[model samples]
Target: MTHPGKPLIEVVNLEKDYPAGAGVLQALRGVSLSIAEGEFVAIMGASGSGKSTFMNLLGCLDRPTRGSYHLDGQDVSRLSSDQLAALRNREIGFVFQGFNLLPKLSALDNVALPLMYAGTGREARRRQAQAVLERVGLGERSHHTPLQLSGGQQQRVAIARALVTHPRIIFADEPTGNLDSETSRQVMDFFSQLNREEGITLVLVTHEADIAAYARRRIRFQDGRVVEDVAQAEVAA
Candidate 1:
């Protein structure tokens, strides 16, 4: 998990553009940075600040229109669509504000979805999913549906789903947005625990400063560019 000086993500002159009527809207302007393995980073900005776009590119959910991205020493910008999909699935896990769980599936099944897509056998998938659910303190809830769980429990399930694949990195976008203040604290505490104990690299995106305070380093964006990047003391619970 810890690679000393090795960077898990490196981008040079990263840029992204969107087409507007009769013109182009530049969402990112030559942003460049590197994130080391086992580091915890937070990306912060207001609406239209381009942090979301930057995260999309970093998460391998979207490609940059200009500039190069190197992930784990591989130039992802040069990969074909299928290759990119495969790499993303193998290297990254995603947690979202919406939970994004299937309504009809049990918690275990929802957590095992990535394994299912990766062609894991039914029994093996169930076993792995149940293990991860237990790791997240949801072992007894594996048979419950999302609708039956509390918001915090649902988020824990999402986190379990992200961890089931044993990915090298996790990308979380507003993961605590839907939870109550106390629940948000609990979720953030869990994230911090993962970073400190397991050394799982984490990149989180949020507009709230309190949420960003949970991270060891903070990167702030303004008008499509990173205005600041600094290391800070993490909030100790």
Candidate 2:
């Protein structure tokens, strides 16, 4: 969780472009926004609207073509790839639709992999991984592999893996895309609980209105620019 009264994310004059055949393709165009700590924000847009690009920038998976990005009050726009990766490991957690769990590893080991990279001792990492699995309601399934679990259960393991890092913010990109309606709801409920109880900042990317409804704030993008940004109260009205 981040300190109160400070923005966890701040992007100013952000822009991204890719080279096309004898031309340039703009992905993000002068986008600017501030997201406070503990805020749950949903980013919505159609394909090619720059939603993924913006998320990549925010997640430190990719750098902006030109912009200023301050994450957790640190300016990350100028950081090197190694530096950004180190910061990402320390400050951010990511969940994807694919669930990306290692096939051969048991749920427990998969969740502990990040901590292993962080150089935790064998017993300490295992304990932390088990604790996160319990937090995600997968205490009894720690020995199971991804193939042994249901789709929903696999996603829970992925969530447990993300939480094991003790990240300050979580970025979920279409996390429920591969799940059924009921499973999606269950996952969203977990996300809501994490935010409310732990003060974890959450930013979710989705195209479905129902999924976006889980977030307290919604931001829409089109043509690489924000079309609408509104709070749930205003949206409800």
Candidate 3:
């Protein structure tokens, strides 16, 4: 049950620190932002700029050293590890550059993995996974293993896997990093389509300006701080 025109993700004075040698390294310095529902945003920075660390915190893969994070109006920063895991399973989807698929599993099964984790029955999982695969234009490759599919097709399968959960938001980490220019465009186009048609919030982390250009909003990080956050004109999908 999604409510339009609401801030789907909100963070205040967010910070993270990691142990480095005898001291600590600050990865995020009082970062604060909100992502409205259905907005597509890209985070960009150089190496060690803390963009990845910010993404990790936003994705709930890591806990912040300080600050509050609210997802879907719930204070996720206070959730326990098990509760965080459950929340992630139900509310978030992820796409990665590596296409982290099981080598032996068919695309259908890989896409169905999340549903299986949520205790979905075999028949229901199959039905939902197939529907998403078809939506991603991979219906014909449903039975193929990751090793047998092209890089783009495998990424599409990964997209289907992310979509199968009907998540509130999707986080993509360098999702087009390994693809060629044309393939990258295709992937970005598909991401935009999803945001437009399904109203799925998207937060992408990438170092390339070209890749970031696909997003409607861009946030740039430098030295663990967001130095720039701006909205760009929409590009035709």
Error of 1 at 137 (Å): 0.8
| Descending-TM-score candidate ranking | 1, 3, 2
- Candidate 3 positional error at 115, Å: 0.3
lDDT digits (tens) for residues 140-161 of candidate 2: 9999999999999999999998
Residue pairs whose backbone atoms clash in candidate 1: none
For every candidate structure, what is the RMSD over all alpha carbons to the true structure, in angstroms?
1.9, 2.8, 2.5
Q: Candidate 3: what lDDT?
A: 0.91
In model 3, the clashing pairs are: none
Query: Candidate 3: minimum summed lDDT over ten consecutive residues — where?
Result: 1-10
Better of 2 and 3 by TM-score: 3
Q: Lowest summed lDDT over 10 consecutive residues: which window, candidate 2? A: 228-237
- Predicted model with the maximum lDDT: 1
CA lDDT, every model vs. true structure: 0.92, 0.91, 0.91
Better of 1 and 2 by TM-score: 1
User: What TM-score do all the candidates reach, one by one?
Assistant: 0.97, 0.95, 0.96
- Runs of candidate 1 with Cα error greater than 4 angstroms are 1-4
